[model samples]
Target: MAQAARRLGVQMACWKAWECDRAAPQSNRLAMMAGILAVSPSWLLSGIGAGPLELEANDRAALLQELQIASAEAVASQKRVQQIVALLGSVPVAGDSP
Candidate 1:
């Protein structure tokens, strides 16, 4: 839900409320959410179409592997960004151009 909220540019609380049935997403948001979940919008809205999509075993495995790689890359990228910020912080600001 946190991931969904982040991707949707909504507050986590709002997503939680949606999940908990405290509120519902607008029609436009329904399509976006369905796309994110890989389900038919109609199914998400009313179980009118296929309820939820299921991946084949091999496809699921491949997706899990891809997710793992992406997660690792994201962590590495964050570390690099933190290192760059620290390095920049160590450098003194110049009052005049050379």
Candidate 2:
């Protein structure tokens, strides 16, 4: 579970809370969790839909595409953050003034 949580980029306590129904991840994380568990997000949330094993080939392909898009977006976002940090590094910090 610790490894799974780390892979999910969540703390162990947050993962445990999800396990205990004390918290719920947002919808984006729902999709990630489903992929990790080989289930559908609907099933992962409410146990009311087919899981990955039960999905048709088209459904599987669609999910894979969505995951790919999300992965690309995450990479783009990370690059933007790095650029912003680099830009911030060049800004002058002033000394405290009375």
Candidate 3:
């Protein structure tokens, strides 16, 4: 849900509120949320359009594997970004007193 909210460009609290029926997203956000969730806006709003598919056992296993691979890749990418940021921090601008 947090990931979905981030992709939708809204705060986690807003997502939680929507989930709990305490508040609703504006029209623009509703549309974006539908896209993020891979559902039609109509279905997301009123449960009357194309909704999510139910995954079979094999499909679920494949999806889990895919998620694991993606998570590992993301961790590696974050590490690389941190290393690059650290290197950049160590480099000095021109005209500095040596």
Candidate 4:
């Protein structure tokens, strides 16, 4: 768990501090799960139960829109790279096969 947190750029000190503040560190597995999920620990530790985190409809919609935009940008970038590679291939090189 510590290694996973480190890989996620979370410091050991922060994890220890969070563990110290919790009344039942062992019982509050949700907090640990939140850390693993890369979510806000407070949302998990202070919630009604250890169930999955809930996002507001608006927030979810915004996130979906952002993902769509990112996907479109990636496709455009890939197409541009393919065009550049094709252009490069058309250029004759010294001692290259016809």
Best by TM-score: 3
Q: How far is candidate 1 from the true structure (C-alpha RMSD, Å)?
A: 6.6
Task: Give candidate 3 regions above 4 Å deviation.
Answer: 58-98
The sequence of per-residue lDDT tens digits that candidate 4 reaches over residues 1-98 is: 59855754556775566568743334355455576765666755665434455789999999999999999999999999999999998999899988
Candidate 4 residue runs with Cα over 4 Å from true position: 1-36, 40-53, 94-98
- Candidate 3: count of backbone clashes, pairs at least 3 residues apart or interchain: 0
Q: Estimate TM-scores for all models.
A: 0.54, 0.50, 0.57, 0.46
lDDT of 3 by residue, 3-87 (tens): 9988988889999999999999999999889888889999987899899888999999999999999999999999999999999
Lowest lDDT sum, 10 consecutive residues, model 4, at: 22-31
lDDT of each: 0.87, 0.87, 0.92, 0.71
**What's the lDDT for residue 93 in model 4?**
86
- Candidate 2, residues 1-98, lDDT tens digits: the string is 89878888999999999999999998888788888887888898778887657678999999999999999999999999999999988776688443
Query: Distance (Å) between predicted and true CA of 40, model 1?
Result: 1.2
CA deviation > 4 Å runs, candidate 2: 52-98
Which sequence of candidate numbers ranks them by lDDT, best first? 3, 2, 1, 4
lDDT of 1 by residue, 31-54 (tens): 888888778889886778866657
